[model samples]
Target: MGAVTPPDGFTFDGLVAKLAAHLRARGSLTDARWEEALRAVPRHLFAPAAAWFTSNHASAPRGRFALDDEPAAWWTAVYADTSVVLQTDDGAGDPLSGKGLFSSSVSAPGIVFPFLELLAPQKGDRILEIGTGSGWTAALLSWAAGANSVISIEVDPEMAARAAANLRKAGSAAQLVVGDGVKGWPEQAPFDRVHVTVGVSDIPMAWIEQTRPGGVIVLPWHAGGLVGHQLRLKVVNETTAVGRFHGTASYMMLREQRYNTRWSGHHHEAAHRSTTRISPRTFWDMDLGAQLLCIALVPRVSWYDVSEDGGDSLLLYELDDHAAEGSWAACDLKAGAAEAEVTQYGDRRLWDELSSAYRQWISLGRPGYDRFGLTVDPAGIQLWLDHPSARTWKMQT
Candidate 1:
C-alpha cells in the first residue's frame, strides 16, 4: 500500500500482467473485474513473506520467517502469486520463524480468483467479508465495486489493524470493523454477498437474519464428526443454505464453534454389542453424515473422536456419539484357516447404516457435488441434485 519502489524487475504493471496470465492458466479465474482489482491493489504491501512455490527447497523462499530480516527478499516474495502467513496461533509466533497455526493468510492467488468467481459481487451490492485477513480481498472488493460497498470484520485485533492499514495504503476506501464475524455486523445488514474466510461449524441464525432475501453468503463450513469436515456453502434463503465440497480444506474453527476435545466423563456411555465385519473404505465418507447431523442437532450435540487398541480383528477408528457418549471402532483380524475379518465395538452397526446411505448414493451414480444444488424457503432448505429430485435432509430434534 505504501509507495515502495517496484524493486527493479517487479514493476506493479508487470506484476499485474503476470498475475492475470497466471490466473488465466489456472482456469479458476475468469472475471475481468478481478484482474483490474489485482492491478490496482498492492499485494506486496500486505504480504510479509509469501510461500514461494518452487522445484526444490533451495529455490523456494523460506517464507515470512526468512524474509523478516531480509527486506528485499520479503518484498520480492510478497509480490509473487502465492500466500503469505499473516498470523499464526493468533499472532504469538515471530513472523521470522514459520511456527504458527496460520491464523490468517492472504490466500494464494489460485484460491482468491476462484472464490471471487464463486462470490460474483455485482456493482452497488453491499458486501460483508467475514475474515479480514491482510485486508487483500476487501481491497479487491472495494476497488471493484467502491470502498463504501464493502464491510469487513476481523476477530484478531492485530490482524484487523494491519488489514486496516493495508486497505488505507491501497486507498481501498472500505469500512473495516474488528470483531467476531459470525455475529455478522448487524449495522450493515442485508449484504448482497457475505464472504467468510474462516470455516464454521454452526450456520448462525444471525447470518440468515442479516442478509436481505436472495442475497448470497459464501463461506467454508466444517462438515464432519471425529476430526473435521470442510465444505463450502452458499446461503439460499432467510432460514436455509446449501453448497457442495469444492476442495479439501481445514481452518481454525470459529471461536464459538470450536469443538470440545475432552473425551472422558463428559458423555453417557451407551450399551451396544461390539461387532466388526466391514471394509475400512466403507466409512470413506462418514464425515458427510456427521455434517448433516451437526446441521440437525444444534445447541446440544456434535461429533467426538474415538481411539482404539488393537482388537481381535481389523480395527481403525471411529466417531463418538457425544449425546450418547458411546465409542465405536472397526477391528480387522485374520486367523490360520480363515479370511480377513472385522469386528465392531460399541455402536459400530450405526456406521454400517451410515455407509450404506453413501453406497446407495454411489449406486445412483456417484454424482459429484456440482449436481447438488440448494432450494431454500421459509419452511426449510432442499438439496436439489435435480428437479423433482429436489430433496431435504431430515433435521433431527
Candidate 2:
C-alpha cells in the first residue's frame, strides 16, 4: 500500500475547539472562558505525549496508553477532553526515567468547572491554589480570575516549575511558589478563595487562617476508613467556617501523608477474592451514593480506589488516616438484584452510619447540596440543611 496519509487532517486547534464545544453543549462549561482558556493555554506543550484514557472499567482495565508511543494514537488522544494520568505511582514517563504508574493527572474538565464556578473569583480577587499537578486547572483559574489574582502553591517542585513555565507560556503570570501547599502561603493569606487540586486527609487549619473571612476554601477532605468528600468552607470568622461536600473527585495521596492508619489497618484478606454479584452500574451508584452519604456522615480523605469483580465491586474511599473505608456491594450482578449491606469498620462504623444517614435524608425528602447552608456562629459552625435541622460542629475559635 502507498504511504498512509494522516487521517484527513485534524489540527490540534480544531480538535481542542471541538472538545471544548462538546463540554459546552453538556452545560459542563457555563462560562465562555473555557474556550478562551482552551485556545490560549498550550495543552500540547504541557502534555506533549497526550495519552488516551477513560475512567470506565466496566468492560476491562484497558487504558493508560501513551500517544507519543504511537503517533496516530497520540494525535487522537491529545484532544479527547478527558483526564489523562501523566504520572503513576512509579514516577514520570521518561523511558530513560522509567514509566512510573499514574498517581497524578490532569483532572477532567467536568470536575474542574464546578469548582471554578463555586470559587467564583472576580479578576481582581486574590486567589490561592494548592496542588498544581498538570497546571491545567491553574491556567483556567488564572484566565478567569486573572493571573495577578492567582497565587498557587505546588508541593512537588518539579511539577510546580513545569506548571509555572506552562502558565507563563499561556500568558498567565501568576506567582508559582515551589513549597508545601498545605502551609498556605503566608504572604498570600487572606485570599478571596483557596482551591486545592490535590486531596488531603486533614484540613490544613492554616488554609482557614490565611483565607479572608467570608472567603471560600475548596478542597478534597479525606478521613480514615477510605471516605473522601469535597469541602467548601465559607469563613464565618477567623477560627471557623461551615461547608459540605460539593462533589467528588480523586487524586493521588500526598507524598508525606499517604495513609492515616484508620483505612489500611483492617484489610479484608480475601478482598480480592470476595464473592458478590452486583450490576456494575448499580453497585457503583449505590457505592457512589454511599460515598457521599459517608462524607456527610464521616467526612474524610481526598482520594479514591475503585474496584470490580465480574459485575460486583466496591468503591473504596480513603483518608490520610491509615483507615480505608469502602461502600459495600449492594447488588448481586448475576441478576438485577440489590441488597443494601453497608459495612462499618474501623474505630468508626463509617459505612453503616452513612447508609443510615442516607435513609434518613430520604425520609427527610433528600435535600440537595444547595439545601445545606453553612452558618458561622461565635463558637464554631452550624450546618443548617432545609433551614429546620442543623448540625453543629466546632471550629477552633
Candidate 3:
C-alpha cells in the first residue's frame, strides 16, 4: 500500500485497469461497486514483495518472484488473475523455493470479485469477514461498506500482524481481530453480513446466533465430496439459516475443518468384495448436481479417482466416523463394464451408500447444483432438493 513507483512501462494504474478488463472479459468483474473497490485496493500492497505464485497452467514450473530480483515477473504476476502463495507448510518451509503446502495468499482476483459481488455489502452495512489473508478482501469490503464497518478475523497471530500492517499502509479502517474465525466475533454481534474466505466443512451454530435475522452469510463450503461449493445463506431465525449453492469453489480448508490424511494399506486386506452395476464414472465424472447430492446423502465420505492395471477406479475414505476406523472402498471403473468390482472395509459400506445416493438422484431425475439447498438449524445441518421439507439429508456439523 505504500507509495511504490512502478517500472516505466508497468505503471500500477495501467496494470489495475488491464486486470479489471481481463476479469470483465472472464465474466467475473460484473458489479460496479466491486469494480470500484477493486480499483481502490492495491493487491500488490497486500502480497509479499518476493513470494511464490500458483501456476495457472498445469504443466508450468513453480518458483518465487521478487521485485528486487525479478521486477517484471513479479509485477506481471501481481496483476495477473492467479493466487500468489504467501506461506508454505505453515511458514516452516522456504516460501521462496515454491514448494510446500500453500498455507495462505492473496486470493485470485477472479474469485475475489465474484464472491464480493455475492456478498453485496451496502454502504453502511456491518460486515464480519473470516480469514483476513493479506487484508485485501477486508479493504475491499470496507470500501463497499463504510470505514470501520468491517471486522476481520485471522487465526494465526503472525498472519494477523502482517495483515494489520498492510491495512495501515492501505489506510483501511477495518478492525483486525486475531482469533478463531469459526467462533464468529460475538462482541460485534448482529452483523448485516458474514463473509468467509476459508472453506467450511462444518456449519457453526455461533455464526447463525451472531447474525440478525434476514442477514446473509457467504462462504465456500466443503460439502463432503470431491468438489467444494460457494454458498449464500440467509439467516431466517436465531437457530436457522438456508441457502443454495452458486458455483464450484476449491479453496484451502479452514485449519479446524481439515481432515486426517494418514491412510494405511491394511484396510484393503480385510475388505468385503462385491460387484456394482454402477460405473466408477458415476462418482468420478459426476456433474456438480450429482456430486452435491452424493455429498449431502453420504456425509463424511471423501473420494478420489485412481488408475490401476491400466484401468480407472474410484476410492472412498470415511472421515470422522466414530462407529468404525480405517473404513474405505474401491470401485473399478473399467470402461463399458456392466458390473465393476468393489472392495469395502470397516463397519461402513461406502460403495453401498454411494450407489444408493446415485439411485436416488436417478429417481429424482438427477438435478443440478442449483436445485440443492443447505439448511443450518437447532436440529443440525440439512441438504435438500427443491424444498426444505422435501427429501433431505442431515449433515454432521
Query: Considering every candidate listed, which one attains the maximal TM-score?
Result: 3
Per-candidate local distance difference test = 0.59, 0.58, 0.83
Question: Model 3: how far is 325 from its true place, Å?
Answer: 5.3
Give the C-alpha lDDT of model 2: 0.58
Model 1 worst lDDT run, 10 consecutive residues? 51-60
Span of ten consecutive residues with least summed lDDT in model 2:
327-336
Off by over 4 Å in 2: 1-8, 50-69, 90-101, 222-231, 255-257, 260-284, 287-293, 296-355, 362-365, 373-384, 387-389, 392-397
* TM agreement with the true structure for every prediction: 0.73, 0.71, 0.93
After TM-score superposition, the amount by which residue 136's alpha carbon in candidate 1 deviates from its true location, in angstroms, is 1.0
Candidate 3 lDDT, 1-397, residue by residue in tens? 2337677678877888887888898788888767667668888889888888875334322457888877777887888887888777777887677776767888888788878888889999999999998999999999889888999999988889999999998999999999999899999898999999988888888888999899999999986778678899999988999998888777888887777543333456679999977778667778888788788778878888887776778888877633347678888867657788998987778889988988888888988778889899988888898888897888754
Candidate 1, residue 395: the lDDT equals 33
Over 1-397, each residue of candidate 1 has an lDDT whose tens digit, in order, gives 2336665456778766876786687675688878877777877767654333211123334444334455456555554555676666676765445664556777767666666777778888898888888889888877766649999989888888888888877888888998878788998688878877776655676777777767777666553343333334556666765665454444556766554333333222443334344444334344443334333322223333232353233232332333344444333433331333433334334444444555556655665545544444455444445442465453322
